[model samples]
Target: MLLHMFFPSKCVTCGSFGKVLCVSCKNSIKPVTQDSCIVCYRNSINGQTHEICKKTSFIDNALAIIKYTGAGRDWIGVIKYKRAYSTISEVVSIFPQSWIQKFKKITQYYTNALIVPIPLHKQREKARGFNQSKKIAKEFSKITNIPTSCVLLRVINTPQQAKQPTKNTRKENIKGAFILKQGQVVKNKTIILIDDLYTSGCTAQEAAKILKIAGAKTVLLFTLAHGKV
Candidate 1:
C-alpha cells in the first residue's frame, strides 16, 4: 500500500492515472475469439494442432489471449522491456470470461498437467531480474491451482527471436537451446509451456520437442499474446 501510494500505477496506454491498464484501454484491446493450430495458424478446435500439422510439430495444442497489435503490443512491451511486471495480471484480468473458463476446463481435462515456463539463459535472467514467462505461469497457477515447474534449462544463450529476421533463422537459432534439468520428471505428464509472446514459435517448439523427447504425454502452449506469422 505504501509502495503504491508513493508510486501510483498508471495505464501503459493513454497514460491514465490509476491502473497499469485502465478498463477502457483493456476493453479496447481485442481477445482471440477463434482458436488456431499453432503450427499452421489455421482455425482449430480449442487451438489443437491439426492432425496433419501434428506430424511436423511437437506441441499438441496452443492458445494465446490476444493479437500483437496496437494497445496489445504496447502492453507486452511495457511488461517485457520496461519491467512493468504488474501489467501481466492487468492484461490477464481483462481477458474474456469465456477464455478464462475454457482455460480452466483444459486444466481439468489434463489433470496431470504441469505449468512450465520457458527458461531464460542464466546470464539474461540475471540481468532482467526475473523471467517474464515464469511470472505469467505463476499467475496461471494462482488461478487454476496447478503446480508450476522450472524443469527446462536454457543451455545456450541464443539471440532474441525478435532480432532474427526470418522464420528459418529463428528456428535455427533456437535449435538445441533447451534441455531438461537433470532428475526432473515430466514423463507421462502434460506440460503446459508458458511464454509471454508467440511469433514464429521456434522458441516454444524447441522447448516442446525437448519435453516430448523426454516422454511428456502431451505439450500445450499458452501465451499472453501472439505476433503475426
Candidate 2:
C-alpha cells in the first residue's frame, strides 16, 4: 500500500493505472515469428532474403523482435530519451528467446562473429551521456555471448532520421555518415548490426553498404522494433 502510494504503477501503452504494462497490453506487443526481407520489408520464410528482393549492395536479412507500437514503442522511448537502464533491461528480458537463435542462424557463416551497434556521432553521444544503441547491443551481447566490437564510427554526424520528412531524405541524410574505425577487421566475418529502432531502413542500408564494401561476408541487421510498419 505504501509503495503504491509513492510510486503508482501505470500502463505505459494505455495509461491503465496498475502496472507498467498490463497483461492485455503486454500481449499486444507480439514477437516477430516470421522472417522479413530487409529491403522490401515483406514476410520471409526462415528470415531468408527473397530471391527477387536480393541485391548486391545492401544487407541480407533484417530481424525485429516486435512491430513498433504499444508497449514496444513505449519501451524504446524510455530507453532512448529517458535513459532508463532498468526499463531497458526489463524490455530486453521479454524478448523472444527465438530471436537469439534466429540471429545466430543468420550469422552462422563466420566462425568469429562481431556485433556492432550503429554508431553515434561523438558530439551527440557526449550530449546524451550514453549511446542507446550501444547499450542495447551490450545487453544483447550478454544474452547471446556474442562479443560487441565498437568498430563502426560515425565520421559524419547527421540529423536524426525520424525528423526527416520522407524516407528518401532519411536515406540521403545517413548516406556517408558511417565508416569503420582504424584497424577494424571485418573481412570474411559476419556482423550483426544493432540498433534501437528501424524506421526507413536507410540507416541499416547505408551501414551495411559500407561494411560489405570493406569485405564483410554478410551484414545482418537486428532492431528492437520496427517503426512505420
Candidate 3:
C-alpha cells in the first residue's frame, strides 16, 4: 500500500513487517460461533431480539461478526481514526465464511431485500471522504447477494456517536439523526442495515425505526465488530 510504503507496518500480533496484520494474526481472530440477543448479549435464536426485549426494540436482529479484539480492533482503529483506506479491505476480508452463509439463509425472509449502509452526515462524509459503512456494505453485498443502498441519510448531522457524553445522551443524539431518502422502495422489503461497528445499538435502532415506519417488513443489522471497548 502507498501508506505502507511511507510508514511501513509491523504485524500487530507477531510484529512481522509490511502489514498491519500478518496472515497468522488474521487467522487468530475468531469468528463469533454463537448468535445472541443484541440487547442482552445472551444466546438467542439467530441473534434476534428476544420476545421480552423486542417489545421495546426497533431491530429484528443485530449480528456482529468477530469480537472487537486483536487484529480486528486494530483494523477498526486504523479505519476509524487513522483514515487508512487500505485497512478497510483487510477488515472486510476477515469476515468469516460461516457467517456469510448464515446471512444467506436469513435473507430468505424477503424475496426483495436491500443492504442499507448507515449513512453519515453530509458535512462529515465530505470531510471523511467516504462512509466506512457504505464501503463495508458494498463488500458485504458480494457474499450475501444483497444490493446496497445509501437511502438512509443522516440529515441531522449530530455529534459523533463516539464523542457523545453518555449512553442516554447517545440514545437522544441519534434519535432523529436518520431519514429515509424520498421515493426509496423499501416498502414490504427486508432491510439489513450495515455499519462498521455496533456500540450501544442506538444508531442502529434509530435507523431501524425509520425503516419500520417507512414500511419495511423486517429490519436486521450487521456490523463488522461490536464496539465493546
Per-candidate TM-score against the hidden true structure? 0.92, 0.85, 0.88
Top candidate on TM-score is 1
Cα lDDT of model 1 by residue, 96-170, tens digit = 788888889887888688999999999999988788999999988887789999999999999899999999999
Q: In candidate 2, which residue ranges exceed 4 Å CA deviation? A: 1-28, 105-109
Candidate 2: residue 220 Cα off by (Å): 0.5
Winner by lDDT between candidate 3 and candidate 2? 3
Candidate 2 lDDT: 0.77
Best-to-worst TM-score order = 1, 3, 2
Regarding lDDT, does 1 or 3 come out ahead? 1
Please give, for residues 107-213, the per-residue lDDT of candidate 2 as tens digits: 56556788899999999899877888888888768766789998989998898888889978898899899988899989888888999888778898899888988
Task: Indicate whether candidate 2 or candidate 3 has the larger TM-score.
Answer: 3
**lDDT of each residue in 1-229, candidate 3, tens digit only:** 8866444477655778867667887777766778778777778878889989888788988787877777677767666654556666675666767677787778766678899999989998898777888888987798788888888888898887888867689899988899888888788988999988887888999999999999998889988888541
Stretches off by above 4 angstroms in model 1 are 1-10, 16-19
Evaluation by lDDT, superior candidate among 1 and 2? 1
By summed lDDT, the worst window of 10 consecutive residues in model 3 runs over 4-13
Which sequence of candidate numbers ranks them by lDDT, best first?
1, 3, 2
How far is 69's C-alpha from truth in model 2 (Å)?
1.2
